[model samples]
Target: MMVAASEILKPTGQKPAALTIDGLSLEFPTYAGAIKALDDVTIEIGASEIVGLVGESGCGKSVTTMAATRLLPEGRYRVTAGSIRLFGRDPFAMDETELQDVRGKLVSTIFQEPMSALNPTIRIGRQLVGVIQRHEAVSEAEAERTARGILKDMLIAEPERIMRAYPFELSGGMRQRVLIAMAFSCNPGLIIADEPTTALDVTVQAVILRLILDRAKRTGTSVVFISHNIAVVSQLCDRLYVMYAGRIVESGPTRAVLEAPQHPYTQALLRCLPERVEPKAELEAIPGTVPNLLDPPPGCFYRPRCPEANDQCFAKPPSMAPAPDHIVACWRRETIQPSIKASEATQ
Candidate 1:
């Protein structure tokens, strides 16, 4: 049986959330007019909590986090609206110098591909040491010791040998572990893991997930895990936000959302899970493709593909909370309250 995240995650006190993105709307400017990449996106991650951002490709999951970290290229995109507070400081107003300090010291990112994230020319030791030394004031020898310690903590045997090897020398899984070590080397307040295990096999993927949860829980670090895999998110995240066509269609505690999904898009995605199907039966797939953002239709972007969409869906529905802490943007939300309550009662 899968352990619930509520059982393992630390309790967040009255302190402000580690990260907050409110009413975020951004567009990428190109020769073919602006493409609205994010639409009124909002998310909050509490201290020491693990939140999952799940969606199909082109749903703006990566863009939302990238914009929060100010990693998107300069002058190429426009934030039409929204504010981001990282540990109570506004990242949008920060300068490059301040951002440099914030990126590694306060917030670190574990990219999807380890090879692309790690430098091929640099040895793993030098790269790890560089991150530690850059973020905190320490001697070269001291940084090296810290790097080695972290590598050992990651369960990378023969730390000395591994550190001396360049990025190209290690396997994908090993390189990813190195990246995870580097992300945790400085003990950042939050870690954004953007599909860090996509390239690995199932066994390696499970190990990577366990390592991330273990380390984050131990260090009191908050994490925003971004992925298209709802099954992985269900197993690991305390809270989940489901996105469709740049807008958050559903969000709540993981168990709550998974047990009684309110949005049609979410239900469709869940149906696509292989575990839900009979053995040897054909897998289900969401019928329509994600909408084009450049010339998106008015009101709900998902209405075009939603099976349950009605006349009310033509005009975007306001967020509704049929259950406490469970929010969905669907005109039919009120009518589903009875089913949600019955499910809860049974649980």
Candidate 2:
């Protein structure tokens, strides 16, 4: 039987959070204007816990992952507020050398496009060896041996052949496996997977998801999974954070939030899922586009599209409310339950 993320055992006397982003706000400067990409985003991932960041496209899910990994470009993007800590170390404050040390060894990322992340010119084995060698004071031969071992552990058939092959020679699923192998090469404490299964087919996606969950469980590694697919998040994550227009709209234990979503945006997203529709029934879509971050409207970022929006929603932004283990930033959460009930009844 596979262990759930919450079932993983933690080391004694360790801090509760392996990763924490407190009041994080980021902006990008373009000729158009400065676009606020993240606003007061606060989230935490405990040791061995899998936390999901879910939103529609352009909702800052990728930005949050980049910020946590310290991979955001320096001049193009700026952090106007908030702090991010990984394993109690401040990645933003670290010098280049120090940051380099922390990146692959302490933290690793599995990007959506494996072709872009992997070097096409280099042999897969050589790249994996380089990663291991960079983080450890080991001989080239030793690094190669370790690389092969990691690939084998990922359940790749003919691990030696895979190491010798270039990334272009591998299938999409195979290439993704290599990326997962590299991310786990150094036994990183925190792994950021930014839609790692997006390009895969359904069957392959299931395999990749299982590989990730299994590895994290075996190693007790914390994961920050970013996805636009709520189904994927619901399957893998212990907790969920819903983002819209750079702001977190709702967050709580995944089951709690999914079963009884408190914010209008979150509730609408769940209702839009394919499973919620009867056969031959038309799909539901959340009306309106995401707000323009450069010139976002006053008050709630989601107000313009919210079904339950009122005068108070246009007058001021809603603060997070104390709702047991859940947090919601909506003025009409109290009335949302009835709306959900009515929507369900219609279906």
Which numbered prediction scores highest in lDDT against the true structure? 2
Candidate 2 residue lDDT tens string, 1-347? 22222233222326567887878999999999999999988777888888899998999998987887778887789999988888888888888999899999998999999999999999999999999999999999999889988888878979999998999999999999999999999999889999999999999999999999999989999999999998899899988889999998888788777777889898888778777778888877889888889999999999988888999999988877745447788888777772453246346
Error of 2 at 26 (Å): 1.1
Query: Over the stretch 3-85, how does candidate 1's per-residue lDDT look in tens digits?
Result: 22222332465667888887889999989988999988878889989999999888999999999899999999999998889
* Model 1: ten consecutive residues of lowest lDDT: 1-10
Candidate 1 Cα RMSD after full superposition onto the native fold (Å)? 4.9
Where does model 2 exceed 4 Å of error?
1-16, 338-347
Q: List the residue pairs that clash in candidate 1.
A: none
lDDT of 2: 0.86
Question: CA lDDT of each candidate?
Answer: 0.85, 0.86
Task: Tell me model 1's lDDT, rounded to 2 decimals.
Answer: 0.85
